[model samples]
Target: MSLLENILYFQGGLGVLANMFLIIFYTCIILDHRYKPMDLIFCQLTFIHIMMFLTAGEIWLADIFESLNVKNDFKCKATFYIYRVMRGLSICITCLLSVFQAVTISPSTALLAKYKHKLKQHIIKASLYIWSFNLSFSSNLIFYVGGFTNVSETNQMKVFKSCSLFPINYIIRGFLLTVTTSRDVFLVGVMLTTSTYMVIVLFRHQRQCKHLHSISQLRTSPEKRATQTILMLVVFFVAIYWVDFIISCMSFLLWMYNPVILTVQKFVMNIYPTITPLVQISSDNRIINVLKILWSKRHQIFKKRWFFCLL
Candidate 1:
């Protein structure tokens, strides 16, 4: 590989690491009640990130054409369909997570509080609905995406992959683009709105505690630290992903006029899924405690299994 390819491959490895951490986190959340409401969304997000990394990694780490040989129509269709569905679902889930988190911190009297009780249960149903929804919606693209053999006038020709839908009944292309654009707009709005709510609530929380000793408030207690970490995290994620999504939307929407925008968009677009794993490990005590608990349990299980074998 060239230097550029090497860099891409290394970055892909980091992406895998991020995805792995998310898998561990999702697994922990699944087995615990503290993050019950977040379990479904986090699990789905983790799975999506894993797929995103693995598939994208193939482009860099493996033979782009040789190893990824879309050997059959089925493989081609599956790859396109799966990636689109997962991408849509990832954005959708992140938007939901942001809204849910914001709702949770509404101080018990905000009108949004009324919906808080249903958040956990609603998440389960919503997750399933979203997967099914995106899957069904994106399935039509499969009919247009295929690996077909082509013939040329050279008297020596091989399979030349091309889209069956390009120049593509402008109507259908328009429709697909519209659906995708609409969904993006909705999710972006959700992210920005919920993120704004988080900012407001967090500012209020900090204002209330502003008089306390800085060291005492920021470092002395686990609860305060966790809350502080989460608040900071809200700010970080909202700033990063929301801006990314906005730039991406503008890029795609204006691609006809400026194609290079995709290059600008790809950096942020690709990394959004990488956030779930790195979320607060550097700051959030709750996540750290969960990781420690999981590590201890894993060790205990290994010891027990070995002891039983000896017996």
Candidate 2:
């Protein structure tokens, strides 16, 4: 198709592949009893991202629905609803990830340290609550979103090619927007707070390390590296998320959608999910070691085949 379509396809394809790989890696680790504390959270986040890309990615869900000859209204509602749910889960899980990482790296005497022992038990329960809350929170999408038709008589704001937001009472819209904004602000606030705590913890940790060892002798712990990676993710996520949030809020409040603005927003939305796996793959020693082992085995197999051919 066009250049934009090509880029969107590439982004969606890459994100889906990377997230799938991460999920598989996590699965293997869990099966082998070598899983880390963050493994479960990472797995959940990747799964939500995969769903997000599949549902909201430019042509993915729409193409599938078109092939199945689904009704446009149903398609719009389903796609938007599912995408919103996944998006909500993404932020919630990400916030949880940051908070947990902060707790994970906190000093033993710190207030957060008290929760460390109960982290495993809390993760599942917290995830369930998050899922339930998002599922309920996004129910408004089903009522407000529907198939876009060419009829100008109907006041609908087109978002996707086939989906538009139907007008609702201003009071209802205001309430929904207020609630949604509140949720986002709360989660993002938590993410930033935890991230700041982590930075301070990391700073103190580095100072202690320098005091105890020479510069060349100082080594990063696994927990420290994981914290740093999550920190990087949080910063990146917050930056991109706010951009998307601002665009979305403007569109929602004005009840207007510009094609160019929507396109940019979609691209921005995809960036975080697309980049997260690459960051994890590069930064995680466990995944790196596994890749190394797999590569060595493959190389040995190739060498054996070449030797046999020579004979």
Candidate 3:
């Protein structure tokens, strides 16, 4: 495999592993009934990222479907469709996460405070709606994508190694593009607005803390840490997401899918998913404590084995 291909595989592997770890961690917290509201959001996001990697990570679905004797066209359609759905969910859930965190941190007298209780009660319902919307919104992809034949055709736009987008009626394409763009713009606008509100809230909270306590005496609350983490993720996601969006738009518009450009886009798309779990693992005290406990148990087991061997 080429260096680019090798790098892609490594990235996919790392992201999948990290996401799996996070899912398990959140699952444990939920089972113990010690989970915060954001834990549910984090778990859902991790699951979506895992699905995205499985569908879009080069060769993952291709190899599986090929082994199953699936038709190439069907494989292409299913793979692209699922990838798009998961991609849509990623943005939607990320936006939800930011909004939820902003609400969580809002002052008691703030307008968002009244909705905080309602948000927690309706989180599951909101997630279901997001899934339903994205699943339907991306239905157009199934009609437009097909297995790419080796023969060059002016009408086909190759998006993956095995999948190309079939030309559709210009009017239909324009309508779909408009709707997709609007949905993305609206979600991104919400994310930005929430993020800005969070910054203002954090600033005021910090000033209040300074007045109440010395710098050395102050410690970060769990809410503050979580908010800061979400803020970091939102900023990073927005940056990476736009790069992928621009590349995808240009490729679709010009019907020019350069191999290098495709590879770079894939790399950019995977960045947020890959780093997200690592950030959560480092920042969350609960996950850290769990790791420490597991490590201590393993160490004790090793010591007992070594003593038995010596005896």
Candidate 4:
């Protein structure tokens, strides 16, 4: 195989491996029961991230074949659509998760604290709104994407370089990106700012509890560590994603794409989405404990079933 081929293969294999880890991590998270209801939101967020991983993974792997051969119009359009939708939703959900965490840690003086129940009650509604928003905004892309061959045959296809032919699709995509980017900046900013304050308050509260010796002055029994983990998640999401956005946007200003650079960029695109669930599982003691219990139960049940069948 050629150098470019080797790069592609390596990246594809690595992405698949990362995705496998994502699956194992997700299964463990689901099995763990100590995590409360909102913890499932973290799982749902990871689901979207996994979708992003799968979409990008397909493009990376399929590019090998497409290099020698080509793709069909339907396949091109479908892959393009799914990739865009999944990526869009993944970012949207990350923003939602950050907002949810921020609200959870909101100070008493904060207005949202008064409406805390609404956050709990309206999570489903909020998620639906996010999906509906993306679907509606991404509608135009359906008309604009097709196979390169089809575009060449019809003399109407615009080249987008990799997996499929896509027109600029810029106006609609830009509009959607604008909305999402604004929300991303705002929500991530809120999450980081608020989460930072919450951490400081928690530490100070810890010190206060340690210094004073009255039962009445005691802080809430043990602190909730979820806020800290969620903060780490937000920080990771923002720092990594912002770097991606900056690199992606720089492509326009630089207007240069060597196969090596593109391959590296593609690797970054594929790998980052799969890393979040592992981070959550590693960082959250509750999630880890719950997963262990779930796994033990599953193993015992499997053993019992095996014994019965053998008998």
Pairs clashing in candidate 1?
A: none
lDDT of 4 by residue, 1-311 (tens): 56765755575555455545545655575587444446557656666665665555465535654675755665566666767777667666766676676576666777767757677556778888888987776555677666654434454433234344344445655774576567667766766776676677667656766777543443333234566666676677677777766766555333333545555665566555645655666766655776688787997889999999999
Per-candidate alpha-carbon RMSD to the true structure: 6.2, 3.1, 2.8, 6.0
| Candidate 4 off by > 4 Å | 1-35, 59-71, 107-109, 149-162, 165-184, 213-223, 252-258, 290-311
Give the lDDT of residue 117 in candidate 4.
69
User: Between prediction 2 and prediction 3, which has the larger TM-score?
Assistant: 3
- Give the alpha-carbon lDDT of every model: 0.61, 0.88, 0.88, 0.62
Ranking by TM-score: 3, 2, 1, 4
Residue 27 of model 1, lDDT score: 78
**TM-scores for the candidates:** 0.71, 0.91, 0.92, 0.69
Candidate 4 residue-pair clash tally: 2
Regarding TM-score, does 1 or 3 come out ahead?
A: 3
Query: Which candidate achieves the best TM-score against the true structure?
Result: 3
Q: Which ranges of candidate 3 are over 4 A from the true structure?
A: 58-60, 214-218, 300-311
TM-score attained by model 2: 0.91
Candidate 2 lDDT, tens digit per residue, 42-139? 98999998998888753577888889999999998998999999998989999999999998989999998999998877887888899999999889
